[model samples]
Target: MPHSLPPAAPLRGRFDRFLILGAVCLAGFVLPLNFTGPPIATPAIAAELGGSPAALTWMTNAFMLAFGSCLMAAGALADGVGRKRVFGIGIAAFGVASSLLAFVPDLFWLNVLRVVQGVAAAAALSGGNAALAQEFHGAARLRAFSLLGTTFGIGLAFGPSLAGWLTQTHGWRSIFLSSVVVATAATVFGLPRMRESRDPAAAGIDVPGSLAFTAMLAAFTAGVLEAPARGWGHPLVLAALIGSGLLLALFVRIEQRSRRPMLDLALFRYPRFIGAQLLPIGTGFCYLVLIVLLPARLIGVEGYGALQAGLLMIALSLPMLVVPFVGAVASHRVPPGVLCSGGLLLAAAGLVWLGRADPGAGWIAPLLLIGIGAAVPWGLMDGLAISVVPKERAGMAAGIFGASRVSGEGVTIALASAALATFLGAGLQAALPGHAGRVAEIAQHLGIGDLAQARALLAPTLDPATLIGVYERAFGHLVDALAAATTVTAVLVLSLFGGASAHDIANTHEAPAARADGRPERVADCGAHG
Candidate 1:
């Protein structure tokens, strides 16, 4: 039986809903800030901590892998244990971990703390929608979701800038300290007032399934992250990749057989659900590629500081903020598939335009185009994803969506890193052909015999302008690759849009009696309805 919402209680007021939204949004801020802060401060952190190139990569990738892998388990746990309680605990733990990071003495300890932070972040990110879905209904629900999207957009936009400023002024420690304060405040305010929202009929925790899924994700991520350091054929990396495949196979089998599976395999049977999930995967792949490439191009290639790089990236966020309103309006009149497809196309065009940008080109035009293009897809994807699912299963639906986005991002970054290494290596090898022996010696000294190693060796021999030129050429290759990848992804998403549109049209024409989950008949169901 479906879990029904409680009758409209006079005690549940607008203020309560606002509190829930505010708390969730505040908690959401910490994770993005933690994720972005290190990237902006990479140079500084690496300098102080005596880290190699690989260590720096771990600082960011560890959080991503942990956050992505644990999301499904966190979602099921939220539904079983209680949304408010899980969210509060997660927020508090994140605060504690972030605070500890402020005093981390070495890169290893920092990575350890980041993994803990990631776990806490998974808890908060997973439960956020379920909490909102439990609190508001109808237009209020729509408004709350819109606000949540806006909060996420703002966080992504501002996180790097905040990190840049703090890293420049007070050092990287301040970034973690700031996260501690923000997370702590959210946990404090949210604990007493946040109401519990759990479906009593949901099955018990799927411990075996969760373990299998986690192992699969961990192994897969480790393989991706290690590919650059160890050749693709390295035994440990190969073994991890093979083990991940086997675990994933086992996970699917378990889900099929378990009475209380963490994932409901049946959701994929709905074309609308499948389309909704794919939208994020496509968007996430493009988004991370752009996010990582833009900063490296601006700061590393163009010799910009952390602040300048962050400011340049703000172009990506500006459009993300404004386009959702367009999506919201479009959602009311246009079919979601039409809006989503259009948004993705626009974003693809923007990335293409960005790829064509010259090293010294005026920044405003490209920035404007990217802002507009990126915004459209960001505004509409989440709401559209949830629209297809039954309201009672919103938590699971959201969990799946979040997992797709996170996993896509992780894979995208890994691929982009590999591509970047290849391009950078080619450029370095070409630029210093006759001096290969000397370059190799320098690379050994620098402990970076990769493409970046070659570039560093050539840096000392070339003039400042020529060094800049070499980096620009290398970075351009990455931009082109990202654009091509994004375009392919956009085209695929457009195809999904067609399928989703057909589903929406069928749903629209169907009689209310035919609708599953009794959504059309119930008012309370509308509030917490995904």
Candidate 2:
């Protein structure tokens, strides 16, 4: 059933407050469950399905690609049609997709199912975030967002250990089934208690803008993910890269001209908004991109079991638990710009320290430092995405925020994974000096990450010691690259922050409300619609 929009009203809880908070928690929990859970299961999935490294990358990227591409459109639909209805449908669809995944026959089907799940996620996640911004206000709004932050933190904290133990004890398929159970429970808890809400002023969906955005993201993602296997100069890959650029230019042109654009290009005028959008890219580079690789590094290279590897990942996610509390204090006292700048600086430094780690005891400190630095700043950005805009546009703002963060994670993962495979291949060629032909075959095995099998295959052709040396060197360089990316993000964010503190800029640049005739009003009155 579809939800209908009524006249605009003050932001208030039409349902039980506790139920509202509970539903928001569920939405937040699912974010990391979908993204972070799969990495823990990747090794097991690859072994069972015989997926190539590129195929395995698609298993994750396909979902993120769809999620990022669909987010703004879904958010716009929620604003015009109904937030609760769209959100409930998304949750139901997500559960169905996860159930189907348990029975997916091959890697191809698995990737397709993941895309479906990602599309569903865009609705539920953005709607839930928008709902929070629409319902709560003042201190309660701050508290609600903080709770939302902790929920995802808990999800990321639980994902690795839970997914690893489940995959090891049951099988890789159990991971999908587990997600089904969680999504079902969230749907049940949310639908009945959730209130229907919408922006009456919202224009109809911008079909061209939506299609163009989706195509642009899809082409770009395919280009990056396939470039490693198909050479960078391959015809299809080159076409995708060029096509994505053209689509991006087209999307920009459309937004600039559309009467009611899906993405309001005016948002970019605020330097603070631009700065807020960029922070997610940093988090994706410094934190999420690394999480995806840690399990492979630990279980594949260091001889740890799945469960043990999952446990080791706790060092990175544990600090996430305290993020909301850290965020609460920072949001109330410090300027957001200052907090973000300082936090990213600390995070970049931590990543540099982590890059130099030698597969030993000293690795723990930098991991914890990076985790804290990344997670705490993330909490500040959660509310700013909605708060910076007029209350009527919360859904739009939430969608863009979701797109930025999810797309950053998706694209960064592809880049990181591509780099990992390329470097490893070069290292193997060096290690297997006399066996040039065998090097290619061994590279394929290692690239897809059947590392134990690669070791076995190489033992007959080269010295075992030399093979281990190659892995260590390749892995060290990958971490160095990740460190470099984070440091660059830090420097860019610092420049974008400019001179104003977050508190000052946010107060001065609050989005103006639009009149019925589409003229802008100067009131900063949040109680009017937000």
lDDT of 2 by residue, 447-518 (tens): 544666776765655455666677767767777787778777777666666555434544544434565544
Give per-model TM-scores: 0.87, 0.91
lDDT of candidate 1 over 1-530, digit per residue (tens)? 34454453344666766776788878766676677667778767766886767677778778887887777788778877887777877888888898899999999999999999888888887787777777765556656666676566567666777887888789989999998888877776665676777755466567888789778877887786666456579999899899999999999999888765667676565455555665655555445556655655566556677787777677666666667787777666666666665666666666566666764346556656655655666666666555544555556656777777676677677767765555544554576687655633332222221234435555645555544555566556665666666566666555555533323432322112112342222211111111
For all candidates in order, the CA lDDT equals: 0.66, 0.74
Q: Candidate 1 — which residues are off by over 4 angstroms? A: 1-11, 434-459, 462-470, 499-530
Off by over 4 Å in 2: 1-15, 435-444, 453-461, 498-502, 505-512, 515-530
Candidate 2 lDDT score at position 434:
70
In the order shown, the candidates' Cα RMSDs to the true structure are 4.8, 4.0
Kindly give the number of clashing pairs for every candidate. Answer: 4, 0
Best by TM-score: 2
Candidate 1 accuracy as lDDT: 0.66
Ten contiguous residues minimizing lDDT sum, candidate 1: 521-530
